[model samples]
Target chain A: MSGEGWVAVVGTGPAGPEWLTPETAGILEQATDLVGYGPYLDRVAAGHQRRHASDNREELARAGHALDLAAEGAKVAVVSGGDPGVFAMGAAVLEAVDRDTAGRWRDVEVTVHPGVSAMQAAAARLGAPLGADFCAISLSDNLKPLAVVERRVRLAAEAGLVMALYNPASRARPWQLGRVLEVLGEVHPPQTPVIFATAAGRGDQERLTVTTLAEADPARADMRTLVLVGIPATRVLQRPDGTLRVYTPRYYEEAE
Target chain B: MSGEGWVAVVGTGPAGPEWLTPETAGILEQATDLVGYGPYLDRVAAGHQRRHASDNREELARAGHALDLAAEGAKVAVVSGGDPGVFAMGAAVLEAVDRDTAGRWRDVEVTVHPGVSAMQAAAARLGAPLGADFCAISLSDNLKPLAVVERRVRLAAEAGLVMALYNPASRARPWQLGRVLEVLGEVHPPQTPVIFATAAGRGDQERLTVTTLAEADPARADMRTLVLVGIPATRVLQRPDGTLRVYTPRYYEEAE
Candidate 1:
């Protein structure tokens, strides 16, 4: 268990196997050990790859373990549900690398492989809500202060940015999303289109709802949901089958 | 040729066939007709599918052509390089859907299948430059005014957001990216990490450069390049192999 050590951070994309990019899949297939949250680890097609699953909040520990294993000559795959770089395991691993003063972890070969992001998949399911200059903001506030999240939300909304909010709500933080809606309501009209897309591409387990900002029920969004808030240029088309297709136009008209 | 109308917008990621997501690949394979920019359409593995390739700026016409074909019972796919929704074809198709007053184009069953966005792939290649909350802004300013792009870029920089700037430079638009760097320089330190990733994942044509805001050579980037600007929190780890890995931490440390 002692040779050139390396770690690959992989994104599975929206909690399904088909979303795996070829590069990410290649890394996962060659992984001697896979580490991630329990739920995300379950989504990997682990063909004899040892699982190092941990709880949701144990990100740092999981990252350290992955780095340590890689340093011991293990081909480790630290998996994230969406794009690993987007508020996911890639950050945690890099943080561990920076802080590991006792080990030769800095020399460990680490790479991040891109995967389909939840916001990307969610926007796709709703047609194309992220068509304009958009921002992806994680509302969890676990990594930063709540005030900072609110400040960013307000600035983004004021800048006419269509936004995709990740980690909108969890059992421990159910009110943050509602607060975000309140902030958005101050700048955007109540008629602004918002989409609550959950478990996109998850087959039979998927749920999608399109509503106006005033009508959006924040309670409907759990940890799995990605909430897309549209800019003023966003439009919703009605299908013959009575479904709604939300998309932002590519061209932006000068604001009156 | 008359039946129910349908259109699927697909993303062929990073100018490489291997980056095609399974969902997007399936749509292209099943398409009776494929429509897109001349280069992007060429990437689709269209086996006997009718191709409706158009010049890059003819997005609306290409979208209209796809809709017309779909209206005639053809399973049509409007293709784009990178993610369709990110400064590409999805928004144009949606705009066409919204503006089509004469035909029943609004009723067509249109779906967007997400692909690995150029920013995502480029960030992966640079080792997670977008590891935290970030925004993607297209610097073309052809669709919108340069003032608007500058305003957003300034706001993003002032808010300490890591930014992925799409269409940063082109033969026709060489100075805009330099102007953007100037604006970012006003708010951020000249030492901020910047990545110039071009033709990412595109076989031997690929190139990657990591530099700082002060040293960033805007001339090195063209339309095919993706520019990622790091926030103050972004860290660069220099490997023994003489390469640098830039990543923004998951948790933001409180500024003194």
Candidate 2:
């Protein structure tokens, strides 16, 4: 093959297919091969496309494989949960392409398709915790040093930006989130709102936990959870029916 | 009309209707009243829904009106461009609810549906400039002080976070983006990549400008543009076809 094929790195969004953009859905339908982690691949219904499943830890290898397939004239779709550009397969594939010393995939075209990210879906579920200035940091130290994560978390907290933490905790790195919480508590008030959203937009599996920094438990978060820590201005409102909503106001109160 | 109605704040994404999520599309279809800024409301087609268009500066009024309609048994969709939860109408509506001192709208239920944000769309277009830890700061100072914006911009830059600047410039606030650029230039090297993407995901109107900190001009951006400034680790690669892609590596090299 003359590398006539192309690769589309697509995000299926979070939860269900209903959150998928029409553009992404159409691209999924036209792909010759679908490549992604097993669970994310499960979101897309099996069709005429060939499925390529891999473990999440093997992002580089999977990206290379997708590139190889595309170079061989196969239209490959690298599926990612949430927006592919945000700590997902989009960068991994781009990294692979950058490291292709021989330029074997030089002629293969690559494109990125955006989707509703996990933080976005989670924020939507909880009203608008990320309505103003915000920063997203993945607490998992699998790729970067824990120190770098800690430094970034502290700076984001100090800046008073609403913080959305991805991969908050997992079996492999349980203590990282606790340490992050410690860093956040040092800068924000004890009453600052903390929200833990699991499987948001995923139907019945969706669960939202709202608490304050003084009472937030890191143990409540896992790999599937997205944790949002609010700035001092973040507010929690209670509806008439007892449901709760959290959002940061757009206008910041510069000290009276 | 016993205040039994509900409000759904829906994001139509950046440009076209194709970027609309199925869930948001369904909400738009079911809403009896569609309320938003004139341009954003134009993205949704005419239907049985009553349209209420307002000026861009009237976000709070538009939100209050939507709430009022919903309280009157109208299934209202408050439309926003890109993810409503991100520097959009989501916070405005929630602010309106928060200020309902008399609790007149207590019975009204509100929900948010996330969509691809402008920064995410722009990142996708540029091949993942936000691949790692990132922060979004709105450069418009209409609601906040310039000193605050500058401080946050400085903190985000010093922390080495990829920065996405929303509302980079407008006719009334043209100098704010220039000030932000000056702050960024102080912290980052001259070679830092600065991208100004306007109308991303919108067909013919979409335009992308890529330059370095030394060459970037604030005049290149407008309110419609989303600007992305890369971290020191950010790299730009040129493909054989003469196109450019920028991405930040997931792993940071700790000081040697």
Best by lDDT: 2
| Model 1 chain A: worst 10 consecutive residues (lDDT sum) | A247-256
Relative to the true structure, candidate 2 reaches a TM of 0.97
True contacts kept of each: 0.68, 0.84
What clash pairs does model 1 have? Answer: none
**Residue runs of model 2 more than 4 Å from their true location after superposition:** A1-3, B1-4
Q: What is the TM-score of each candidate against the true structure?
A: 0.95, 0.97
Q: Write the per-residue lDDT of candidate 2 for residues B153-233, one digit (tens) a residue.
A: 999887779999999875566788888889999999889999999888787989998899889999989778999999888
Candidate 2 CAPRI assessment class: high
Candidate 1, position A155, lDDT: 85
Write one digit per residue (lDDT tens) for candidate 2, span A136-172.
9876556777887888888888777899999888556
Q: Write the per-residue lDDT of candidate 1 for residues A1-256, one digit (tens) a residue.
A: 1246788998888857667777777677788999998888888856689898888787878899998898888999998988898989888888787787776687688888888899989988878888888899887646777788888888888777899998898555678888889999988989999999888888898999999889999998977789999987789988777877788876666750
Residue-level error in angstroms, candidate 1, position A162: 0.7
